[model samples]
Target chain A: MSSGIRVASLDDIPEGEGIAIDKSVTGTADDIALLRDEDGSVWALDDTCTHEDASLADGWVEGGYVECPLHSSKFCLKSGEVQNLPATKNACPHRVEVRDGEVYLFPNEAP
Target chain B: MSSIIEPATGSGAGPSASGGERPVGAATAAPRGALRRPVEMNRNIDVSGLVDAEGGLLDRSVFTDEQVYRQELRRVFAPSWLFLAHTDQFHKPGDFFTTYMGEDPVIVTMDRNRRIRAYLNSCRHRGARVCRADSGATRNFTCTYHGWSFDLEGKLVSVPNKGGYPESFDTKDWGLVEVPHVESYRGLIFGTWNPEPVALREYLGDMAWYMDAMLDHDDEGTVVVGGVHKWVLEGNWKLAAEQFATDWYHVNMSHTSALTVLAPSGKPKAEIVHRTGRQYTDPNGHGAGFPVHPRNRFDAQTVHKWMDYDALRERLGEARVEGPLTNGHATVFPNFSYLPVNGSIRIWHPKGPDRMEVWAWTIVDASMPPEVREAQRLYNLRTFGPSGIFEQDDGENWSECQAIAHGFITNSVPLNYQMGLGSEREDGRHPGTTSELYSDAAGRGFYRHWRELMNTPAWHEENR
Candidate 1:
């Protein structure tokens, strides 16, 4: 079953960008990739990339794709389809919600 | 496939492209470079017999024969794909870096399109290297030997005798001939003497998986940083790559000095390394992986002081840190090694049969803070660059190894690669999906393929 929770509010992420927060869920120290769409909504995903194990939160966000900082491999932020050849697999996107002007991530063990 | 580029897997070629003195292709008459082609022992080679469960025995002739060396230049170095500098090396339009494609000097540049291009360094008219500054921004390359200028695209834009030459000499036909095909598998650039060769990525195969890790998978995205540290060393190209590819066994002895500096406890170096990962051999005979780090000597030196042991723990998390902290080295066949140390990529490229010109670059996340970049570069230079204590010392021995092997006696006697011959474990089991590194896994794998390529005709494939 997929865990659900709130991560951030609309004011947290400005337009045309992304934010990275520590993930303490999964019972292991992990990264939570937090991104806000132009419409000002909260989204979250696993920060560790499956391809090269690099942190996806540190990657560049443009349009709707996140370009991995290492090799320029782009992944669609909305769905995490590996948008390039260098990366063969998709990133794990997490579920999120915005409640009371705060972003709370689901399965919120905060890993 | 008519291109003169050497076959990557299929070692055999027709008589014209044959390995040795057996005349082949446009090279049948005589060689243009310092070396000559081999006669491929021009028979239908049975590669099966050359190597075995142990590995191929590389005749010293393979390393020192002037004729065989020439043959390698043509069949191996000439046609095969050789790496050039990375795209990031040339940051500006006029930026250029000079490297060798065999003995031929080449200048890699960034054109107006920001696309990468390379040209034979020799001038079109008088055959002198058109430009020489090691690396810098130049609007165009003007031949110092005789003032012929060419643009970054290698188009012969200026010639002295514009109107003087008879209608015979055409400027359009004399453009700086590009080095066949130039392509980047990730940010790593490679070129070939032939008109075309396989895509660089396809040539890498499973090797690409690790290359992605070394070049891409990082928080900030790794980059080619500081600058390349170049210095000449005396050693055959294959010898150098072979040393890394399959000769982990040699590290205990060949680099015994490293141990003295590293641990200095009078312990066996190999055991102290804490190496893991399967030492795999690609179908074409390329070798990779020797997961031996954190514990890798250089890392051991820095982990406590420079690198934040805890920050690293937080960043890499627990999985990667404990597992392949020293991920197996990723060898790029022939003569290249992608040394990814937790988070750095060091590249090695050979210039000729002996005497390799090294190019060292650090791979780090693009978003890395400058201090991190500086630390990585310093670590890279300290361990492998010219200033590198290890490299400078290794060069003295490697070059001397070739020079001492100069006589017919040393060249004729076969070198013994028989270490742990019967005990080497097979590919039966492993987590890293690699061959065992307990033995000289890289050495056996490299020599076996060297003989296959050296013996097989350039035009023939085992199946074809």
Candidate 2:
């Protein structure tokens, strides 16, 4: 239940979709992308599609899903579940928390 | 017996060989309908009794014969319940998807009544295909050829000139030849050729039990997340159908290269996974499964401990998925491979004896988180795509096996399946059919059933 290490300050970017690369998953400079939905909330998931290695960060966001550009398959950002076809699996999600004026992601892969 | 069956079967008797004379490579003892005999032997093949306790394996002719391919369209594919797109394809009323039942193009749609319907694509007028796209939603169809139109119910609602036909013309009979039966089990839709094929539920039998592990669990259970990747291949339709249905033996050799790459550069021995699968050939031409298992994985205690049915509160309401995922695959009669991989159902419909189109789709647990879905997709693509290590290797072998038949002598020769020939034992009370997972019984059983389907002139009586 420890708070995530501070990785970025609040004024660095607004809502919608944002990127921060300094987050470390076991010491690797894991580049994570923050997707802000219409509600101004944010969720972080692995930035790549498992099928063809397509970039998931730039994908179209709708109804809490990020769709891969190559095949148009959608994945749930929160749980990393692939909700659509062409893809049969899920993506990876991370822990994100806001403290003071900074946002940090605790990278974990237990799911 | 060996020398008499050879003949020029590559083209299955063209104009020259078609004159009803002895065909090239044809055995002297071969009767008019007999062209399946192999031509040579020695480290290759020995043609003798291609037809066995199960049935007959095709000579090179089955692959190249146009007449044979046409006959199969009716005898094998037509009468069999060909798998079509799942119910997910028809998202709502008026939604539709087209698939081939052998050579016959089919149209499956969700009507206004919310019921699913299927029909031949041919127009009621000149027999031209009525629907042209892969899939769509529409209230009615207007044939571009002669302006013949029909509604979602498949009833001919209009014709450009009503009087174009004679007074005796009956529109009811002309309605798109509605597939007599369309049934969906756990979101998978299938159509049959006979006025009645065995109750699909019954045909499915214990397969449903296995399928439940892959599909039919949880809410929103499975959805068509994307479309199919179709490709043409040169091989008997049965090869593809049988490969998925129950051909686990090929993995040892056909996939040797890919498996080598996936594993730590090795060391001499092949220890990828020790397998034990058996084969069970039914009375009709159906029933094939890997019968292969990565030995000793599904333990009784494990099922009791992990997936306790007391949990069947969700989807099977938690009772299922509690069991370990064992067994490789369970293929239904004619077509449809209910696979254990990526939780997908593959329908390898026959185009001709030697040509086919592959349609694959993924089924995921609806309640699963998106991250899990994404991971599964990645694994599925790496393993099953056209270029996937597994599928790519399979494609090469299936085609090469077909290509080897072109040689006059090689084409007529027979391949040995004599392994475990006399050691096979049949058990009656297993609740399921069983064969040696490590032997050639699967292939032998497959060929046996193929012969029965091909030779049987009558559907109800014992196959000839």
Candidate 3:
């Protein structure tokens, strides 16, 4: 059951940056990170890194990759593939959309 | 790999360029200012033994065990925040100072953009130390071995005989390994290798309030005198730190002779009075024993000229001046300690389980007059310098205790730490855990924190 849920508005996330949405949101139980790529495309991934529990939202984002702050492992948002050492497993990617200035997230099942 | 600076000098074809030359590399020796290389245990380490803090019992072997010391280098020193250098030391770009975090040599320098950075002193190639000078301005550090060079920012800039390596060699992956975290409080800089350790502010906790009295009293702040007085002690580093933390009890016995000479009457005082002061031990293991001189103690006795109570009163007001500016001793957990009385600040560098190097500095308010600064320096030399009367007395006791730990029968028994146990209570006058001036609250708390850190592996697989 993949239902579209509005998570935030465009104003909540600036361009070329990412923000973490977790328990702060009333309906969201698990962590879901929403990122706005440099190309203005919105992407979502499981907030926690597979290698370590560090939040991907806290990781540095450049272009399509988010580098883990813990060990500098770069993970690609599109393919969910880790691009650096110390992190061998990929993050789970989810479907994201922007409609009428509202951001919607379809959470992906954890691997 | 051999780029000779002053060729051969007086040797037979010293280190031929074709390699296969000197069996030992030219850079085998440590750099000019490097401390003695640390000694490590050849056998496996076991840290299963514990210190029962609440029970007031500590295993004697914790101070003398070789394996436990090895574990401490990684578990306690590497992960926790350790004082590296002071910001005042770096007046301009390229200025740097070489220091030790545990036994690991590190260089703290200011880059061209004036950003301070800390790097492992070891070279990326062959592990020879990169920086040699103790303190100076430098453009780059060229490894005496293999002729590899690193820029001020610790980036590998040039490598001699580059064509000898494979075509895929990448310099990006070979820069000097940097200490991952660097932060400063007031002017003191600290670095940590642990990626997920607590924030520096939180690590300091309430200790910052007491430190502010010394470092941040005046608007200009405190400045460390130019040179450092360094010496080696044949004792575990913790003994010195713990003493400074919560052992005011030793002052009477340890310096009884010196007191008789310095006091107006040439007699050992019947009883020492510390009614003006209180002791505090933070949960983070930081501890301080500060004397609150009644505003009128300035009139009854002579305070150090550098202490300038009148100036303090004007700047910080009477309440703070009485609370923090008075004579006191404090330890910022693990090793960094300072005495507000004589302006002696030091780091007890753990050389091994049974040895430590004490590097001390005399700090004064940067705004103080030249005469006051000189008096402060002289006072520090007389009281806390390597050969000072009080320092020697303390050293003798520590060395004797360490010697006893070497014996089989001596180290088998547990030592007592029960002074003021189960008697500590919260006091409104100060924050954190408070106890009487003469108590083992800080000592017991120190060991508890040590046990937790020693047991908590830095690289635990658990998330969060």
Candidate 4:
């Protein structure tokens, strides 16, 4: 039984950018990063970078990946896989659904 | 002198001289009072018998003893002025670089007042590392563990749950531990943990005259081109330091294959090996060995085009500029060393009695053209970087020496350092004691100073 939380609207995050959802709102272990690709697809992953204590919400989003702002480690938005050095572990990805322009985050559930 | 070099009489079983056994259960003890205090160990090991400076003999146990390595961290490194970083690395307020001083992690920062300072990187609360990045600019270093924030000056500015603490809990008492002394000379920043260290220039002594040829060529000075390169080598840190200080004789033998393969400047091996040079040994433990007339081994034509010979001769006297130009290495006492020809400066960070981590940087004059700087960077990488041709050869010898140094039979044998022992003389040209190129005067001087520091517990007791 999966419960969905209405985090934000589809238009809340701009193209090639990301925003953070606090853990208090999603009830997850870490803050969630809501990223919007250039093609208008939405993805959700843990906000904290695996290599260091830095918010991925402040990172730059492009194509299907987000580059960490602290050490520049990149992570795939769709599956939360690490793409480069300085970071080895994959980030935790969460499920997201868009119903009539409203973004619903299935906290702690894999995509 | 005979007593100092006496053969080890003990069976070479466990820790000798100091009868205390190595603590095995200390790590598992419950953390109660003074959690950050280091484990207590026997510091009185009687190091006077380890080095015979004038007789030119050194005991092998200095390279393998755990007690001696710990004492060195306190007596040798704590009071000495150690190089931290170049001034160019800090251009504005909040610029910072992380480095180590005898395994103690330090954060060198440019405060908001534009003054440079150093602090122990461990947080005041729980001793967690406050800054983790290698180099960056930031206004506040916030601890990720519990949200304790410190300003650029290392003052604890904010803490979570301000109302939870008692009214007597003042934030002023919780700032990061600051290094007591910090100074700079010729753009190189140095710091010391001693509350009252001698002035930087005074401690450097006449070694500054020899360094001016490479550091003070232009009015703008020099800047580090590429960021630092760090790697670990399985050897005693002193092996690398002593080699850079006093052992140019090993180059022709150890690096013969490299010299033959690279043939830098297209010069024949005979021409490069036949050049006569001099070795300088300073009373302050600094040492430099360089040829009287050095040929630019890496592209002489390009170097000639970039350097203004007449201007350099006018600024630094012809005697100082001509000798010690290119193709030489010098060490500033303990761990900091540099090679002029390779455009590399490094610190030999000791990991233990048998291992070290090298942090190196390629430095070039700020006045050089972009192409020249790029050439220097590439040349440095090819010659002295971790996987470079010459470094691999040097690392092999050092690691092998360390492996043999720990053996019970080998540890009883004394290493001879008697090459040119009585040949030191005053040339009136250079400031320090000068000897033949292939001499171990500088190596002897290094051990002499090391013995002095090990025997004397306080800086005030030093005869300097």
Q: For every candidate, how close is chain A to the native chain A in TM-score?
A: 0.70, 0.74, 0.83, 0.95
Q: Which candidate is the best by DockQ?
A: 4
Off by over 4 Å in 3: A1-111, B1-49, B268-276, B295-320, B460-464
lDDT of 1 by residue, B1-464 (tens): 11122232233321112242222222223224466435454324333443453643556766665566655555566656677766667676668888777677888887665556677787768788887788887666767664566666666665654677878766555656565456666567777655345666677765554455455444444467766666566786666676656655545555666567755566655545655545666655566656533433225334224544355446554433433335445556676675665343434455545667666666655655677666766766666666665556656767878887778677767676655455444444322235466555556766665656656444322232
- The lDDT of model 1 is 0.59
lDDT of 3 by residue, B1-464 (tens): 01111111112332221232221111222132456333332232444466999888898888998878888886788778898877778877678899999999999987665667777899878988888888997667767776677777677766755678888677755777666566778778887767556778799998887787778767777788759888999999998999999888888788887676667778754443444466888888889886555552321122353356677778766645766565677899889999876778899999888899999988877887777677777777877889887889889899889877989989889998898888677777676677877788888888889988877755522231
Off by over 4 Å in 1: A1-111, B1-55, B254-257, B264-277, B292-330, B342-354, B418-433, B455-464
Q: How do the residues B76-148 of candidate 2 rate in per-residue lDDT, one tens digit apiece?
A: 6656667877766776766888888877788888766566767778775677877788888655665767656
Using lDDT as the measure, which candidate wins?
4
Estimated TM-score for each candidate: 0.64, 0.63, 0.70, 0.74
In model 3, what are the clashing residue pairs, if there are any?
none
Name the regions of candidate 2 deviating beyond 4 angstroms. A1-111, B1-49, B54-60, B163-166, B217-220, B264-271, B277-281, B288-327, B419-430, B458-464
lDDT digits (tens) for residues A36-62 of candidate 4: 888998899999988767778867789
Scanning candidate 1 chain B in windows of ten residues, the lowest lDDT window is B20-29
lDDT of 4 by residue, B49-140 (tens): 99998999999988889999988887888778888888888877789999999988889888765667777888778878889999997766
DockQ of 4: 0.04
* lDDT (C-alpha) at residue B33 in model 2: 46
Give one clash count per candidate, in the order shown.
Answer: 58, 54, 0, 0
